[model samples]
Target chain A: MPKTAFQRVFPYLLVLPTFVFVALFTLYPVTRTVTDSLYKPARRAADPSVFVFLENYADLFDSTHYLGARFVQILGNTFAFTLATVVFSVPLAFLFALLLNRQLRGTGFLRFAIFYPALLPLIGAASIWAFFYSDTIGLFNTILRGFGLTGVNWLGDPNVVLYAIVLLNIWKQSSYCMIFYLAGLQNIPRDIYEAAQLDGAGWFYQLRYMTVPLLRRTTLFVVLITVTYSFQTVEQLQVLNQGNPADRGNLLLYFIFQSIGERRNWGYVNAMTVVLVLLLLAFTLTNFLLFERRDDDKA
Target chain B: MLQRSLRMLCLLLVASLLAVTPFVQAQAQVVVDFYYPTAVDGPITQTIQEYATKFEAMHPNIKINPVYTGSYTQTRDTIRTELAAQDVIVDVAVMLATDLTSFVEEETIVPAQQFIDRMENGEAFVANFFEAFLANCRDEEGTIWSVPFQRSTPILYYNADLFRAEGVEVPRNVNELIEVAQKLHTPERAGLLMPVAGGFPIWLYQSFAAGFGQPLIEADPAKVYFNSDASLAAVEFLTKLGMPTSEGGFGVGPMGGSVWGDTPTAFTSGQAAMIYHTTGSLTNILRNATFEVGVAFLPSGLPNENGEGYAAPTGGGNLYIFAATEPEVQEAAWLWVEFLASDEVQSDWGARTGYVAATRGAWEIDPLKTLVEEKPQYLVARNQLAHAYKEFDSYRSIDVQLIINNALSSIISGNVPLSQAKATLDAAQAQIDSLLAEYR
Candidate 1:
């Protein structure tokens, strides 16, 4: 009844490759970045590298300094961008999913049309949008001027720039979220809707009662994906904003990218990264608690 | 059967080893990996490849690999990453001339002077480049760090059709600029477009500083004068471009400022009567415009003692050799650099790409001469070189650039009141001083 050597070692061998890769790529970099966050690079050839533990973090939030002002503004911009994108895109995606879920003529073509924006590279989409948003001689401006109205600066006004970018993000991302919602929709038993209809439930009632409750887990999953995506996108910002109009569009990831790419301020950026990771971790923990409690209640 | 299979495997392995021997022998030919950046609109990568092919045909023992890294900043980032990881992918690269300080600080580059010293006509080679173009290629102690290649200056591109219709003469100085712009201003068309709204405004802003008789930096990399009297005058003039005359402003461009990529398009379409853009964009704008385009020096804020009022900041990339590569590879890379900066190649590159040819000799050559004769606007940028100063560069240049950019943006974009302009600049100067304090 004793196990053979091959049998005993088979499971460990199976997990080893993945473990090795994770350790090398993910664990190693995370450790290195955390360590790097604590140390300032030597600014001069004669100077030694100095460890200033939490000072890097403090420098980011000290309002008397320029970095502090930038950090606060960028952090606010990132959060607002994330909140706006999620709030708008999720409902729009759900609507699209609901529409596409119904059996209709030309639904396949319509679905593809709706999903086409998601297929274009974000950078390409941002470039195309840049032409549309140009303050002078743009599509919107030309149309506005044709009607004898003043054309608004979509990308130039700090008040309107974030919303302009958010609109693009929604246009690009809603269809991607729609794909998930469509898949989630397909899994729901059709008979539930049919039964609700038999009980004289209206379309709104059916969606609110049967569909919404059934898709809680899917909605949760979609929210998590969208939130992560909102935090990570730097392409649109790079192409469309470049922190222009007085750096109003500067966001967390773009700030970090500028820090690393332009300034080579590794220590400061790493501290920023640590703060970002902590924020994301908080969100994930909240989601876990909610989902875990829901599952326990179901059981 | 097992014995027969084992013998077959051994035979295959030996055959593979024999196959690899010739591949290893191909290493006798030095392969130089050249990475260059394209900041302008054109088929730059294709042209570089064509040059590489020609270079290789001439020297069969050497191979050239031309890589098109994105922007100057992106190219620097890529190279920095390679150096940090000790991967050493690039043998030679085209980076911003202003990047000399940072690269030298990193000690990742071999000074171009060393290579020139070994050449037969080293002094003649150094003398070939315009003094203005060479400004960014030297350090505080005057060691040449890079060879100027795709060099440029910010010049004024005006809609000549609009100027003629409005009875506006070409602006020579600040007063003329204001007069011409105010006359040309209309509800439908902006009078001026200063493309100083984006991530790196310091390049264009430096032109303003120069016009006001205060170049941002000179021989000293540790020192910068962001809040000097001349710099303050420059900021005041810039801020006024977005304000109304009733408010003691020029009433020209938008208060929020204009985008870099959008400026050329706007000027061509007649949305703006004039624009300040890089000479690198000359070809694209000239080709696209339906109306006659007038190229002029950036209007001066104040004339110097010599009565030379015009001022611009020289820009664009320089070719540098990496120190990490093998000696033979470095030698090959130097040969490739020499070929690229040669008069014939410089002429072709400038004529095709609209860059001001780096060497004076290139300007006197065939295609460049032919192009200048056909479109005299091509000569305005080169003429402006007399008044051009070094682009803003200092220790920790990237950070310094961003600080100056933000400070300028805050002032010019009206985020901060004009009254606070000095304070903003002072703060930025203080920040840069602390950042560069160690170097001093």
Candidate 2:
């Protein structure tokens, strides 16, 4: 029995290296960030050793400075961006995966076409989109001008910049989500669909009752990953808009980066980072509570 | 069979380790990494690589690693974080003109005066550099913490073809320039292009403010002077051009429609009539432009009634040696700096690239002078240098610049009234004052 126990524990022991790597690389920095957030350190050259406690966090709420307002706005923008991405991308991915599964001619080519955007580096993709968003000499503006329509500032207009970025995100991420959805589709038992057909169930009925329920885990996984990535989206904002047109497109991650990277307000950036970690924790815990029960019920 | 496999694996491992061992030993070859930000396109990366290869060949004992670390701001952040980790990985860096003060405060850079004093080969290295370049390199104590590498000032680049077509005379002063711009502007074409983007607009406004005898920051360099009447007038003038018609705006400012995409494309493409851009853009313009380009001084906001012009700000990059590197490496780095700053090298670099040479002797070099005679744009930059003011480089200056830029953007977009804009700037000045107190 003890031998069996040791054998059972051996696999975990073998995986111990990965655990140590994660702790050192990920947990260490995160813990450091949390600690640093509480203390303000002088970041400039002349006076390098001054430390003030909790003042950095207090600066976050100093309304006159606009940092606090900017933070709240960025959070709202991040949530909106993530929610829109999930709403548009998840359904379209599922639909595309369904169509791809249909043994249609040139389906492989179609899949390749769909997957192309994901292959591009973020900056490269953003650059291409920035060209398209250019007020003059852009493909969109050219077409609009040809049609005698006024060219809108796609990036410069704060009202539309967020949506424009969302469009870019959808283009890049939907294909990625489709790959996952297609895998889930392929794993659904052929016999179950056959049984459904024998019972004279319609295609819609089978898809509604049989396909979606089986893909619940996949759907949950995609939503979680997509939301996490949305919070971390910096490249598009950094390259294309750079929080332009009155700082409208600024997201939380980019805001934190601007604080530390551009401004060198390390203490303020750390405090914001701690807040972001708390947000991520809250999101993960809520997701677990809501979905883990459903997963158990389904099983 | 297992013994044979083990013998083969051992042989493979030994071979691989032998192959890697030389590379590991090569790392011990006085390795010095250089971090530079390319102001131009990716082709500059090749130029940097060539410089590195030459340096390595000259000093066979040292291995030079050249890294392109993105924009100026990105390079600053990367170097800071690396230094904070106590990693003296970057032995040399190309820093923005304004970044010297912050770097010195962090003790991330060594004073260059000692290196200037130590050069071999009977070279009068420090004396050869342009006088205007010293304003940025010198610390508060008048110590040379950095050496000017690439120097540039804003100049007016107009499409001569467009001016001829429109029968508009080149403007010598701001008022005439605005009148010409109004006449030259077509809805289908841009009259001028001012970057409403961060920093560029502020720089343009500061140029005008400087011409009007207004300082961007106080003499102490501890507080912003952007809330002053002169600055307010400059902002008002800029905002009139940038605001939309619905907001009672004029249109895009000077470089607007005419400025090209990345290169001098807009002017070359006949999209705009005139452009105000850095002298560094001269080479790109000359190389790409098929049209006759007219080079002139930047429009003077406070031109004498007789149309005499005052100088604007000179903006560009400088090279700083880090204090943490070994003495030998510092010597090698200084060798590179001195070589680049030599009249022959500077002239060649200036002729090849659009950037003006940091050394004054570059103008006396026959080839560079010939290039300038052929291309009047080069001469325009040289003439402007006489009137150029160095941007403030105190630790709080960048933050102050950022604030001014943000406020200027608001003003230009017509989101804030003139009084409100002034009030906003006053608040920013207060913030700058606090930063100055804390840092300076």
Compare the candidates by DockQ and give the number of the best one: 1
What are the TM-scores, per candidate, against the unseen true structure? 0.94, 0.88
What are the clashing pairs of model 1? none
lDDT of 1 at A148: 94
Tell me how candidate 1 scores on lDDT: 0.86
DockQ of each: 0.40, 0.21
Error of 1 at B263 (Å): 1.4
Per-residue lDDT of model 1, residues B267-375, tens digit only: 8887899888988889999899999999988887674335465678888899999989998889999899899999999999999999999999998988999999999
The TM-scores that each candidate's chain B achieves against the reference are 0.93, 0.86
User: Local distance difference test, per candidate?
Assistant: 0.86, 0.74
lDDT of 2 by residue, A1-299 (tens): 35788899999999999999999999999988877776655565435544677777787777555466356667788889989998999898899899899898999999888888888898999989978877656678778988988776676555677899999998888888898999999999899999989999999999999999999889988888888888888998877766654556668888777666443567778889888878888998899999998768978
lDDT of model 1, residue B147: 93
